[model samples]
Target: MIIRKAIKEDVPSIVSMIADDKLGALRENYQNPLPLRYYEAFKRINEDPNQELVVITNAKEDVIGTLQLSFIQYLTYQGGIRAQIEAVRVHKTYRSKGIGQKLFEWAINRAMERKAHGVQLTTDKKRPEALNFYEKLGFKASHEGMKLHL
Candidate 1:
């Protein structure tokens, strides 16, 4: 498996993979032509010094997994940086083969390289496996992060 930074060429596959996940209902809103908003976000994240998108591919160059990482500057912790992991998913066929773990480890190490004070991620409470995975990766629960869905 090869892990590399994402490029525009990877967008179609990435979008398709996310759309295939039942948990991706939230993303379906941006499907079809995959609006400018999505493009802008991909560009912003890929171009920003503190953000990144990684694609895991087979030796054949077919993408099998992907993740988005954001390195944010936080003033609450004396301006220390925090890396946020988002949209992490592995193809169903690739699950249970240590691909997700490897991708996560790579993200965490990259965050450290950027001088981030910590790395964090959020998963649905219903996803017990995701919760367990994060715990195994040494992440402790911080607090309840409430969201206002309007």
Candidate 2:
């Protein structure tokens, strides 16, 4: 398997993997021809210097997993940059093969390479297994994250 920056063609596979989960099923709209908004968002992400959208592909170059990493500039922590990881998903058939770990490792390394002060991510409370997996990766429950949907 190879990890690389996602291309336009990989969007469908990425969305499919994302929507395969119970939580994601409610929020993601995956169809034969995906909605225009997804592509528009992809375009914005691709054009942004601080955004890195990546995909893991199999030997045949089929996208099987995906994640988005963002470098956020903050005045706190002495103006340090923080890496925020989001949208991490592996194709249902590809789970338990360490693909997710590999994706996190790559993202964390990239964040370090960019001189980020820390890496952060939020997982839904409903996913106990995901929380455990993240804890195993050395991430602590250091902060309580709250969100508001606009």
Candidate 3:
């Protein structure tokens, strides 16, 4: 599999991967005349120097996995930059094939190259398998995550 930064044309495929699962089916919309918000967000992420929306394509150049990495600079860690991994999705057919591990490895290497203090990610508590996968990748459950939806 070849991993690379995602382009606008990959949006539909990415959306389909996201909506393939139960959780995503509840929150993602994959319909004709796809929402403008997705495209707009993609454009913004593409334009941001600190954010990367990446896709992993198969031998046929079909997208099979994707994830986002964000570099955040903050004062708390002595003005260190932290790499945040999010929106990870591997097509159901491609799961259990080590694609997710490859994706995380790439992200971690990218963070190291950028001099990030550390790498972090959050998995839904309901996803025990995901949590275990992350732990196997050397991530720790160091803190609680909270959010307020608008």
Question: Which of the numbered candidates is closest to the native, going by highest TM-score?
Answer: 2
Q: Which residue pairs show backbone clashes in model 3?
A: none
Error at 80, model 3, angstroms = 0.3
True-structure RMSD, every candidate? 1.9, 0.7, 0.9
lDDT of 2: 0.94
Model 3 C-alpha lDDT per residue in residues 92-131, reported as the tens digit of each score:
9999999999999999999999999999998888789999
- lDDT, residue 102, candidate 1: 92
Clashes of each: 0, 0, 0
Which residues of candidate 3, in runs, are more than 4 Å off?
none
Cα lDDT of model 2 by residue, 1-113, tens digit: 99999988888898898889898899999998999888999999999999999999899988988999999999999999999999999888889999999999999999999
Roughly what TM-score does model 3 have, to 2 decimal places?
Answer: 0.97
Which residue runs does candidate 1 get wrong by more than 4 Å? 29-36
lDDT of 1 by residue, 1-150 (tens): 899999987887787777776678554554667766777778888888777899999888989999999888889778899999988888788888899999999999998898889888888886798899989889899878777878
Q: Compared to the true structure, candidate 2 yields what TM-score?
A: 0.98
Q: What is the lDDT, from 0 to 100, of the residue 53 in candidate 3? A: 95
Lowest summed lDDT window (length 10), candidate 2: 14-23
